[model samples]
Target: MSGIACAVGLLSSKCILSAQPQSAGRILLQYTAVRYRRKPRWLGTAKSKLFRVPERHQQVEEEVAELKRLHNVYHTQMKAVRRFLIDEVEASKLVSRAGMVIQTPEEEASEWEQIQRINEEWNRKIGEVREKRLADEREQRKNYILERLVAKEQRDQENRERVEERVRLEKELARNYITRDNIDKAIEMALVQPMSYNFSIDLSGNIRRLGEEQNQESSN
Candidate 1:
């Protein structure tokens, strides 16, 4: 009877040891599941921050470029205005010298008529100069606007490219991070993040929509 009880106790202890391994494995699996659940949220936050940094950098670059372009335009306009003023002053001096050459009243009248004709011709020329300058200004404005638009488009495209690059890197990084058991789900989640906007029409539309939404919310 004593021998039988010892064997029974030994068998029961072996069964308990076997059961403990399964329990420990179950606990480990639960911990792994919890870690898996937490990883995506943390990874998403990290990637969001990464994307924001480039966007901010892009905005600053665009603003600086715009400021420099406007400064160049300002200097060009100032130079044009200065040249026009100098031409006017020179023409006035020529008119004064011609007036001094006239002597008798008749000659003076004839000279004055010639001066008048000259003045009229000069005035017409000045008017033409002014118009040309104005046209040049209009052309510069058109060109500036076009340049800004083109630059804006390029910046937007760069942003899109950066985003794509970031996304690709994020995937590569995720691949490096994931274990064999979790790779499929990680890949799927990575692919599911929405593509961002990076075009003129989309940017304009987004701004307009934001304004409208804000206005509507404010009215409420």
Candidate 2:
């Protein structure tokens, strides 16, 4: 097939080169006849022969058709190549954009971590404040209990003192009443000594001594 294609190429090249001379010779012959006014029958026959050279014309036409087909094919192939190149360029652009997107999360990761750490620190500080507040409340409660206990003890002491004072006043009032009665009885005994026994004054003094002994025993 390769040898056949080579032979066809050689034959087509020779025919194109040969067709130019035939065309020039036919033109010269026609011009000479026209100038001499002696038209030859062989010239007319040659014109017919030239016209009948359809094999060469057909060959030329076929060559032209083949060339046009080859040009169209080459144009289509070039278009396909251009499309593939454009697709490759667009794909590279997409890959570059993806690379930039991938770096964003990595670049900001440290800042996110810092934010989390700050939040944890704030939470710890809040917890500490709460613990301190709770401790202060507990201390306040303890102090309140101690103050209440002290106040209660002071009140109990005051109540005991008031009871003791009431008892002392009652004893003093009874003693004063007993002393007034004893003196009055002694005066009556002394005035009636002549009318009654002469020893009534001594008897009155003895009764007073007995009352004093009874008062001393009641005090204890």
Measured by TM-score, the strongest candidate is: 2
lDDT of 2: 0.70
Model 2, range 3-86, lDDT digits (tens) per residue? 544444444442212222355455322221112233334333333355565554345888899999999999999999999999
TM-score of each: 0.27, 0.29
Q: What TM-score does candidate 2 get on C-alpha atoms?
A: 0.29
**What CA RMSD would candidate 2 show?**
43.2
Cα lDDT, model 1, residue 13:
46
lDDT (Cα) of model 1: 0.72
Q: Once model 1 is optimally superposed onto the true structure by TM-score, how far is the C-alpha of residue 80 displaced, in angstroms? A: 64
lDDT of each: 0.72, 0.70
